[model samples]
Target: MAHLSSRRRHSRSPLKAFAAVAVVCAVAAGGAYAAGVGPFDRGSDAPAPAAADQARAFLADWSGGHYDRAAARTTNPSRARDVLRSFTAGLDIGKPRLTAAAAERTAGDRVRVAFTAKMPVTGLGTWVYKSHVPLQEQANGSWKVDWSLGLVHPHLSEKEKFRLERQDTAVPQVEDRNGKALTGKAYPSLQPLLAQFTDGGGRPRGSILLVDRVTGETKRTETTFGRQAGKGGEAGDAPVKTTLDAAWQSAADRALESGADGRNASLVALRVDNGEILAMANTPATGFNRAVSGTYAPGSTWKIVTSSALLLKNAVTPDTVVDCPKHLIVGKEFHNVETSEFRGATFQKDFTESCNTAFISLRGKLGGSELGDVARTYFGVGQEWHIGIPSYDGSVPRPADETEKAASMIGQGRIQANPLIMASVTATAASGRFHQPTIVLGSKDGTSTTPLPAAVVGRLRTMMRATVTGGTAHVLADLPGEIGAKTGTAEVAEGEENNGWLVAQRGNVAVACVVEQGVTGGGSAGPILHNLLSSVPGDPS
Candidate 1:
């Protein structure tokens, strides 16, 4: 590319070519005449110490009206004559008066010289400009402009050098009670979301809703990317603070990590006093939300919903006795599970062990739609709703025959529920009345409670307690609080494989855990609940 001086070549149109030549000729004639006058006539003027020094002196003399004097000092007289030629080549100076000048020597065998040039005219102000001349000493010991001023430097210090680096920012932290980071240390799978927070330039924000047993509130706190955004606002840019006890949340996270052989697990914990989720988590190894979303036969857990219907209609009491034989003949088919029979057990006892036969018999006596109404109106089923996260609308089969009614009675046939909804149902038994589950803290401004009789909750609690103590959920017998629980293992269509679920509550904390295609709810799912409860504080009383 051409340097700055070459840019002037475009400005010098063909029309102005002769005028420039006339100016050069006039200046040359004057300079030549002065050279003849011998401006510097010192006979003993020896050669300068260095070629660079000679170039500097030449520049100074030329700017002081001593053109011939400067030419004489050059080590090479021929090269010095050329310097004078180029200087006058662009000027119309008729014995031009010199102005000011400065010179410096660089590391290389090159000299930098600067000068101010001025032309005096009557009407125009003094037109002043600065010039940087780069001079290269030739083998003949004289100098010539290496290129142009724009190519080199006018000021000796005007030089620089420029480069680019990648630094990593801190990942967002999930902490425990002792201020320890749970996600990074124990749950590495969560690292991606933390990394996303940093990589996304601190715009990440979300909210976590947790349970409050004391006043029936689902506490909500916003989460943000950085410290400032974590404060929360209308833009929702704030660090989320959840009702989740970080320690309990850690335990839940840890327990879900069990069965490392890629079996998916999901868990949800709530406060029984008012339905507030303490911890809701899922192992998305397969990107499936089985906890609050898996809709399947709730199996034996539906027995509670059925028992609720029987109690509400006065069709059965906690003390009402029934026989649970290994199989109940519904039409021509047989219906049963591991211990389908409870011999002669009360309604509460039959419920504790999850006897399908006893409930199947109860359904025939009560009729199907009666159970369906309780399931739909009291429990959430076949409904679109919000309960923190999206959920699968639990269902109750509208049975067309005795066989379907028998199956529906035992949480089979067309009935379905995600673990989250079941937890809500279990919490209702613990609390006496049902309260809508919330993921945020808000007053019930105009909302009212559904008045379920205290008698219903009292009996349901007894049945759940019996399950934990002497029945199928005996696995939770020694849990750290007054534990009430129920277990379920439902057979999936086309296979003997079943989905296991265990839901329980201790004082204020209620929990539901699910293991897909597992042995039984009392096996895999119960242990997960136990591990999670073991991490909670103060025995939940």
Candidate 2:
């Protein structure tokens, strides 16, 4: 292994070899002249109190991270400063303690000073090593070190570096709201989420490495956090506490599996008042965490957000007359699911039916950015949300044209959301206030929204109630509480089946679910939600 290092650093190619030699010589190594000594006037012609004092001063500066001052005491100040800086930064080792040992004045005017360096490698004990510094009296009557990279480390050659790498990594522990252990086996829907934690935080310990700079090959393990795992493996990183309710999660897990009709589906339930995620479940249970991360065209369930913007602007009322035509076109043709049309329908009726043409007809009522601003300001869409883990905050891109704007008004044309976002939307609409959804405890809330006008919120809630009572989302009407909801059937690419979506609020629990290829939000997603929501006792608040 000693053969790996050399007095003269070599490169893989001749040109680089020449470059390496030039770099090494720039550090004043030429003064050593292979014999570790140089020709100079004897001490009889020089007046030096102690050459060893200069060595101790340089060591003092280097130990205190004063590389510039220390380099000034070296023969080649510029090159010594660069190598010294690189040596400290490259290793990321914390402050070191340097002590000057015995100093020997050779038979000439030169003196050799030996020193011990104690470096504290992170996660490991201190590492001590001994090295010698050659000092020569400059023509200006000052002692300067014949500085070289080798002075930084005895075997340090050109293009060599040090780094600290973990030997054993951290293990993530996910806990329920009350701090009880929650494993993937207990909640199968959390398998994908657990995989993220596991991949990031593995075992618990580490190592520092000496490696080749150009070709990142490890030369040796300089030090380690521990030879065997110690107390580090006990707790790993702090336990990640979630807002999930075990009973509710169990119900959600069951309902999604049983009612998804064996198709891909996801569901999320949140507290309307506080925005704590109560339950999140996905069908198949072991693959993607679609409930929080999957992006889908929200279909008509997005009407909750659109309605808020319009109501805030006083553009329409629940009883406002509107015409729902078979198809409406701006840049492209737009129609309700199955091209359903209702002439002379009330705004509430259009909402209950999830009328695409009806909403598209009102695109001129607001500015291009108004809808997106309303979503972000009032619903936390497109805002940074530290939900205790990685999450995709919903994005509402500014529409490029009237067609895109109209499509966005109806939750299509590049609008994307997941069950977590839609569930939060429903919770906000139901409670007339926005509380950023949080699964993990102590997560940050989204930017505050202006209070939703009570009259407008009343109307929105009325419309959602009507949806469950006598409209498309009537599938959930028979549930044992005042369940208000809106359904959506979002179109996919030309040939794919539309995704079904529904968001419902019963008591203080706001729930949202999506079913792929389910055709209509009311028919496919509603029943599943009914089963899940019904299973849990209604929130008293």
TM-score, cand. 1 vs. native: 0.56
Clashing pairs in 2: 167-206, 168-204, 168-205, 169-203, 169-204
Q: What lDDT tens digits, residue by residue, belong to model 1 across residues 341-369?
A: 56778888778877767777777567646
Instruction: Give the alpha-carbon lDDT of every model.
Output: 0.54, 0.70
Leading candidate by TM-score: 2
Misplaced by over 4 Å in model 2 are 1-173, 195-239
On residues 188-256, what C-alpha lDDT tens digit does candidate 2 reach at each position? 787656533332222124576788988889999866644345543443357767787877788888888
Model 1 bad stretches (over 4 Å): 1-236, 259-261, 284-286, 441-449, 539-541
Listed in order, each prediction's TM-score against the native is 0.56, 0.63
Q: Indicate which candidate wins on lDDT.
A: 2
- RMSD each, Å: 37.4, 21.2
- lDDT for model 2 comes to 0.70
